[model samples]
Target: MAFFQLWNSDHGHVLEACKDSLKKLQLDYLDLYLVHFPVATKHTGVGTTSSAVDDEGVLEIDTTISLEATWHDMEDLVSKGLARSIGISNYDIFLTRDCLAYSKIKPAVNQIETHPYFQRESLVKFCKKHGVSVTAHTPLGGSAANTEWFGSVSCLDDDVLKGLAAKYKKTPAQIALRWGIQRDTVVIPKSSKVERLKENFEVSDFELTKEDMELIKGMDRKYRTNQPANFWGVDLYA
Candidate 1:
């Protein structure tokens, strides 16, 4: 549902990406389509998405493309019936505000990294207040990415999460995800294990008490586990 090349928003490949995804997915139309990131980069190859980088490995960015222009194309996709809904990802309030200001078809969702560690309450509040639904992408705090990529701490292992898990009789991950859902955000937790997947689905059965919510809220480290700067050389979140 997300295009990889929102970096070069000015090059105008929204239709091509949508069609390519449809063909690959074997679908006639997508339920929702989203711009993966706000930054636009020049295409590295035709019919392929490549992140063009300089010798220093900094991502090549194009400033000529306006988000409004690209968003208009997104609106076109909705009008053309290629996608039922259109949204943005990794956008904070300022960029989201800009999209809302210029958009004829307002964004329905904003997907961002949200978990106990980096709650991003202000941004979530802003989006919800303006009718933008939030989708939480690293609802468990990017444990895999943290361990494999950054060698950083995972929110799932936090003492607070452990305490809550013990209190709720749930896994730490379940508690973290439950907290996010209770915050009125949709959580898309990534897991390959069948049992783990089932466990994630089971969070809807229990509601965290207000006292427990406050306890988990106090665990915010403002820590982001997926810092791609190590490889991309540019911190996209930065």
Candidate 2:
């Protein structure tokens, strides 16, 4: 399935941006289209992700357009057959609840940063309870690249995960992915290497035990790996 995310700067041009993406992909419709973030930023241009920043280098958030209005345009995408499914990303429970209340088409998915280290139990429960599927974006806690790019530690390095890996004869990454799958959240772990891709896919061969799942549950440090604050100059999570 072809999935694409509309950048925050493209909120105002949702229609145009989606059309641009479809055109670039040469597809009549997208399988899934997501609002990259709940917040809106100054419109740079269609198909552009560069955000407008203020004098202090903070992102220039566009407060003029409400998320409700943006979501309305998103709903229009479905009506026009531009996208088959619509969803949100990086949204917390409060924003998601608000969206569910106001949205004509309930969001099919809420993609969030979730892993053993940052198990957002309440948010996951809320979305699933309301019939919206949760997609774990950083399902394996962003792996080592997170540490290199965001200076955040990977959950794969945790001793618990490592120990579990030894017991399951799986890699630490696979153990983490298994934990996410058992939670009923769709896990999308990223890796470019062919071996790593194969390793990531091998999780389906083994099932994490109930006790093992509980052990991983206890690994939650409430730590979010992907921190955009260093670059955005603002903490959206805060």
Candidate 3:
């Protein structure tokens, strides 16, 4: 998979950025390509993410290039065979609905921050209803790294997941992943260690009961673990 970042959201830079990604990845085609965020930022250059910021350090959003226009270019990628599938990321339900309305090729997926603490059930249900798959990016509540970056505690530490883990003889992370999978959402948990990678992959063996799924569902505090406002100086989600 590859992502179209803020700097490459412009109509002219989109194709070049994708080609550049293919060259760097040494691949003939990408299985999936996604717009990293809903909003566009100043075009720094192809293969560059150094989007310009205002004096107050807010990301200089490019209002001239709308997401509808960007989606048209993304659709072109599918037609050109550069990508087998193209999607969006970090989009709320309203933006997602807009994309569905105006898109020639419907978005295949919406990658978003979701976990026990931030289940986002409505968004998940809506996307699935529209034939758009949901990919959970921070499936394990972002772990310790998210705690530092977003100041939100990891959902792995929650009593619900830990209790369920003990019952199933699995790690809290595995329980969380199972919950996401049970909900029909694809999970991408970040891990660097070999043991952790193995642990994360070992979730398919167990399935959460209907009641247990409800327990985790009730654990939702509606808290988002990945907040760009810390660096972007704008609350896009707000």
Best model per TM-score: 2
User: Candidate 2 clashing pairs?
Assistant: none
TM-score of each: 0.93, 0.98, 0.95
User: lDDT of candidate 1 vs native?
Assistant: 0.84
Q: What tens-digit string does per-residue lDDT give for candidate 1 at 94-207? A: 999999999999999999988998999999999999999999988998887667888777889889899889988999999999999999999999888999899999998899
Question: Which of candidates 1 and 2 reaches a greater lDDT?
Answer: 2
Residue-level lDDT tens digits of model 3 in 127-210: 999999999999998998989988988889888888999999999999999999999999999888999999999998889999
Tens digits of per-residue lDDT for model 2, 15-53? 999999999999999999999998899988898878788
Prediction RMSDs, each to the true structure? 2.1, 0.7, 1.6
Clashes of each: 5, 0, 0
Winner on TM-score between 2 and 3 is 2
Q: Best candidate, lDDT-wise?
A: 2
Evaluation by TM-score, superior candidate among 1 and 3:
3
